[model samples]
Target: MKKILGFAFAIALAFMASGCTMMKMGTAFIKLEPETQEAYAKMMDSIDTYGDPAKAMMIETKINDDVTNDDAVEAIKAITEERNMRVTGDVKMFTKEDAAPDEVKHARIISVCNLTTAKVFLNHSRYYGGFMPCRIMLVEYGNGDRFLITMDLTLAIKGGKPLPPEMLKAALIVKDTMETLIKNGAAGEF
Candidate 1:
């Protein structure tokens, strides 16, 4: 049984070496919480990987390849209004031409909120508000490629476990809303 024990130890070591990414990846499913649909997950997986892998493991990321920065912005605006959520904040990043002009072609953060969900999430942990107003990053490459990056909320909001039912529900609702918004925006559709 020494060989079997060794194999198991190796597997455990592999998971631990990756900063617990294996666990975070399944936090929602492990907790039986709602997660991104299969099609959506697959789409995200197929996109061009442009960031640090180590950073990726710590968060939920969704990226779309076909949507332009402008298209994504318009789509998000339409979605927020249709869904009765308010656009909470918009920030443009990495824009100093002298610093790293070509590194970031286009990078804008679009954040929106369903106030009730905000209230519930905040009630669970006021600090959680730091993650507020579901946000998506609209990105463009100097080579003319475009992408929309979405944050998955299940882990940040519900993966903690032992959260109240209302908090979980609110988290799920906002997570679903964020996914729908990104998918629709990325496809250039309403």
Candidate 2:
């Protein structure tokens, strides 16, 4: 009976100490935007589903089997132009000569940007420059699999304290535009 009481006392002390630590951790997140929790939850879900932290932070779509790489690239370009965004850079990272016989056959990175939106974000915070000119990658593996991948923007959109109204609007526009570009581009839709 005495041993059981002593064990119970030790457990209570441990809980008390951990409770203080948990409270401190919780307070550290007080300044984050309310939506930050939801954004983090979504990211965690992605990590769980994909089993890769890098993959969780990206949005990827497999190109349709019928869609050629050139067609997909062209579709992405057309959509960017239609949406008032410019193709700032397009680099072919891997080509036949650059790869081994059993390696990636084709790999390209296309960068798109809206100058006005870019300026808006830069003016708001210089750190936003890191994300400037969003990029979409088209990669075709050796075995004939192809995919379009881009960074997922949930954390950028909601991880910090709430953005100003204008900034939020601009961010959402960029998000929607990128998502459309990837989804439609993969399907070869202009």
Candidate 3:
């Protein structure tokens, strides 16, 4: 009986050690928490100013039109409406264009969100509120230039951490919807 007890104890220690190794391996890859501001900034920085995605999950598409910045805004609006998403905000960058309107280019961002998806994500982690109301940016070197920019949903969600199964499903929904918007926005189709 004493020998059996010793064997059991040894087996338990081995299991514990294996568990610790697995935990350490997981931690070794976590450079930074995905939900932190630093992570966010890093992700954004991975993309170029012109909408080209570098090391980050942010996606960018060049606009090859000779129209105006307003075109990008309209494209966002139409796509959001078609996809049944809500337009939360439209921000104009370099509002100080008064400093030199023609000296630079035109840039703006349109924020959109679907309440259903937001609710799912929030239920999983309210902190995600920071990324709420996803954004679609329209960048034009000149008035008529075109570029479509937005976060990559898969990358953003995965970065946050392995979400609960329900949250994962919701994230995928948001991802597919966002992808549709990006494709349509880039193609200038609703």
Candidate 4:
């Protein structure tokens, strides 16, 4: 009878401790951007679908059957200019005589940026530099499937404490522009 009473007390203490931990976590979470929860939920959903956490952190669009890699690249460039973003860098990966035949046949990463917005973000936090000059990758698999991929910007936009109003607005514009670049690039649309 004494042992049973002691076990009950232990269980009650565990619950209390866990409850306090939960309360602290909830408080911290509430201090983040309002869309943080939604961003996380979408990331979780992506992980479930792709079975890869890295995949969850990106946005990918399959190129249309008629869209050639060159066409897609051109489209991305055109769209970036039309959207007022500058093409900062264009990297063509794995281009060498010793490249493996079985490896990806084509892979290009185009970096785009808006200087003013980038400066704003940098002034806000140097951490933002890691994400500077957003990349749009064009990759062609061995099976002839092509895709345009970019980092998922949602978490960057809402993962931390709420951004200042102007910063948030700038971030959103960048996010939208990136999504547009990929979607239009995949479709070979300018």
Instruction: Point out the higher-scoring one by TM-score: 2 or 4.
Output: 4
Q: Model 2's lDDT to the true fold?
A: 0.89
Q: Best-fitting candidate, measured by TM-score? A: 4
* Local distance difference test scores for all models: 0.68, 0.89, 0.69, 0.88
State every prediction's TM-score relative to the real structure: 0.62, 0.79, 0.63, 0.82
Among all windows of ten consecutive residues in candidate 1, which has the lowest summed lDDT?
53-62
Model 2, C-alpha of 11: deviation from truth (Å) = 22
Give the per-residue Cα lDDT of candidate 4 at 57.
93
- Candidate 3 Cα RMSD (Å): 7.5
Between prediction 2 and prediction 3, the one with superior lDDT is 2
Q: What value does the lDDT take at residue 150 in candidate 3?
A: 79
User: For model 2, what is the error of residue 126's alpha carbon versus the real structure, in angstroms, after optimal superposition?
Assistant: 0.9
Task: State, as a TM-score between 0 and 1, how close model 3 is to the true structure.
Answer: 0.63
RMSD of each: 9.3, 5.2, 7.5, 4.2
Candidate 2 lDDT over 1-190, as tens digits, reads 9999999999878887776666767876787888899888988998898788988788999999999989999999999999889999999996774555568888999999999999988998899899988999998877778899998888998998888998899889889999999999999998
Q: In candidate 1, what are the lDDT values of residues 4-56, reduced to their tens digit?
A: 99999999888888768757776646554344344345334544364443334
lDDT of 4 by residue, 1-190 (tens): 9999999999878987876667777798889988888889988988898899989999899999998888898999998898889999999885333435466777889999999999999999999999988998888766677789999998998998999999999899999999998899889998
